[model samples]
Target: MQGRTLNFVTKSMVKTKRIPKQARAKARIAAILSATDALLRSSLPSNITTTAIAHTAKIPVGSVYQYFRDKNDILEQLYAEASKQVEELVLAEQSAVDPALGFDHINRTLLQCFWQTARSHPTFGALTRWANREHSFVEVTPGTDSSLARLIMRTFEITGINLPAARKEAVLRISVTVVSAVVDIAFEEDDADKAQTLIDELALLLSGYLA
Candidate 1:
């Protein structure tokens, strides 16, 4: 009876402390990532650990484990969030409609959106810097599509490009890939003109594919 009572009390406490949903988990994760961003500017990703993140967030290291599997999992969640943020910006700002064809219109818009998003979320650079050189959070999901992929599909459809499902699928991943690469460059470029130049060049190349 005593052992059973102890187990019940422990389990109840654990349940009470559990994060409610993935959203709550993500919120805590975001707080941790923001702390990491600050720390990484002065240190490297490897130097930043669960203890560092929790200290930065002023939360207990033990509690952090409740949400993230580890530091890499935290980094991966940050990557996914960063990608989603950019994707949301593109989707929200889409205003062009072209059925006659050509990716030019969409490319310019996408570049502009990408620039704004990267600027708004400066930590994105640090996240990408860590994600690419070290641990990437990419996972293969069958029949699963990204928001950026859906945006690309919408653009292609608007342009009257009758792309097959496979190609349409490929285009989304391509757009995310290209936009992300530009982000890598944009973050390092201090000059606005230089950043705009890169955007224009990328937009032109993407447009040519449709034209």
Candidate 2:
């Protein structure tokens, strides 16, 4: 995850294909994405085929190509969309944070939002798995300067703690790394109680670190 996210922070992502203009064409494209999402829930991205997506979408294979270059292209778009959804979730939750309540309250609120969003998204775990396996180099959008990062920076800065620019970046990077590691582990556990425990510990760990 470290190498992959670092690559995202450093490199450019491949541009996707042309957008559909007409309503009918747009519907076809939407169907393709929806089919891809459904298929992804059951199979790894590498194992999914363009033909399979075409069949699932009930569109001609050539029509799928009309909107996407191939299966991987479809996956890339889906991955981008998924990341955007998660980013929005983070931003919305961050906006509701009450700064006067102190770092611990702010920390727990943000972490809970992230965990709940991840759990609610049926494809979140699958997307992470696919990303780790196939396109490790592809930069997930918003990069390292995500809304969550900005929120964290702002929270710490308001406390009147003077951190150098370099130090600020390092702190955000380590915090993101630590939280993500624990969240990833929580996602894989079958036991709901254990998953909640992992997330609780993550909140405790991050709150202490930031405090």
Pairs clashing within candidate 1: none
Model 2 Cα lDDT, one tens digit per residue, 1-211? 2232311221233334767789999999999999999998888777889999999999998898887777877876676677567767777876666667777777787777777776777776676666555633223323346544565676676444456787777878776566655765676687889999998898898777766
Among these predicted structures, which one has the highest lDDT?
Answer: 2
Q: What's the CA error at residue 130 for candidate 2, in Å?
A: 1.5
Clashing pairs in 2: none
Per-residue lDDT over 82-154 for candidate 1, one digit per residue giving the tens place of the 0 to 100 score? 6556656666666544445356766677668767776667456566555545522232211114444456667
lDDT agreement of model 1 with the native: 0.59
| Residue 38 lDDT (model 2) | 95
* lDDT values, one for every candidate: 0.59, 0.68
Model 2 quality (TM-score): 0.78
Q: Report residue 24 deviation for candidate 1 (angstroms).
A: 10
Of candidate 2, the 10-residue stretch with the lowest lDDT total is 2-11
